[model samples]
Target: MTRTIRLRFFASVREAVGIAQEELALPDEVRTVGQVRSLLVARGGVWADALAEGRALRMAYNQQMTGADTPVGEGGEVAFFPPVTGG
Candidate 1:
């Protein structure tokens, strides 16, 4: 089954991806947030670099912080951003 997800990019991630938000439909194999990242990375170029493995990117599903292994579902909203830092 396909899952329709709303993707949100923030801060530097937004700058790198060059979009604030968009809707994506995932293939059944793309079940986890990390898989979604992989799909995007497969696009190559900036996407591959910005969300590449080992990068210090943060993820959120439905406004709550999430990990790579978290399962994604229908109508879910996922966000990606760099780790927050405060002085």
Candidate 2:
């Protein structure tokens, strides 16, 4: 069954999407954080440009920072944010 996942974007990603979050229904094959990012990129235009592989992106799964291989399950909140900056 397709699962609905929430995607939250911050910093540049947020600016690009003109929003902070999106709800998506994904298939079982999309089991990792990288897959989710890839799926969003396939939406084209802003999604593609913002999530480009060359860009630096930080991710979180269910509010906990995570790596690309992190598993994502139904009802999880996956967030994408730009590299942190503090000085």
Best by lDDT: 1
lDDT of 1 by residue, 9-38 (tens): 999999998999999999989999999999
Q: Give the lowest summed-lDDT range of ten residues in model 1.
A: 1-10
Off by over 4 Å in 2: none
RMSD (Å) per prediction: 0.7, 0.9
The CA lDDT at 73 in model 2 is 92
Cα lDDT of all candidates, in order? 0.95, 0.92
Error in Å for residue 58 of model 1:
0.5
Write down the TM-score of every candidate: 0.97, 0.94
Pairs of residues at least 3 apart in sequence or in different chains that clash in candidate 2:
none
* Cand. 1 Cα-lDDT: 0.95
